[model samples]
Target: MSALSTFANRDELIVGAFAQDLSEVAERGRATLDEEVAATAHPYSITPSSLSHS
Candidate 1:
């Protein structure tokens, strides 16, 4: 039981770390995309809201 508990704890920690990394990556990607869109001067002008459904 003790060994199983340790293994589970380790697994949870790894999963939590992975999730944090993924979240950071997603934030960076969104920021880069937003910067690109803002830099682009389109005729109609496409804002972030215009690309969203809601």
Candidate 2:
């Protein structure tokens, strides 16, 4: 018997909980990517000289 099965007679709850957690993480990741895309300038845009540290 699996650990979850031992704790809960039904395995569905374990699966459902995991799926919900994964969905939340994916949504946050997508939001972060969207913000990055919006902040970046066009092809000719240049970064400020002082900001370049490399």
Choose the strongest candidate by lDDT.
1
Candidate 1 local lDDT, residue 33: 96
- Residue pairs whose backbone atoms clash in candidate 2: none
Which 10 consecutive residues of model 1 have the lowest summed lDDT?
A: 38-47
Clashing pairs in 1: none
Instruction: Return the TM-score for each candidate structure.
Output: 0.76, 0.57
Question: 1-54, model 2: which lDDT tens digit per residue?
Answer: 988767785667788999999999999999999889768857666658647987
TM-score, cand. 2 vs. native:
0.57
Give me the overall lDDT of model 1. Answer: 0.92
Cα RMSD for predicted model 1: 4.7
Model 1: CA > 4 A from native: 43-54
Give the alpha carbon lDDT tens digit for every residue of 1-54 in model 1: 699999999999999999999999999999999999768868688768789997
The backbone clash count of each candidate, in order, is 0, 0
lDDT of 2 at 20: 99
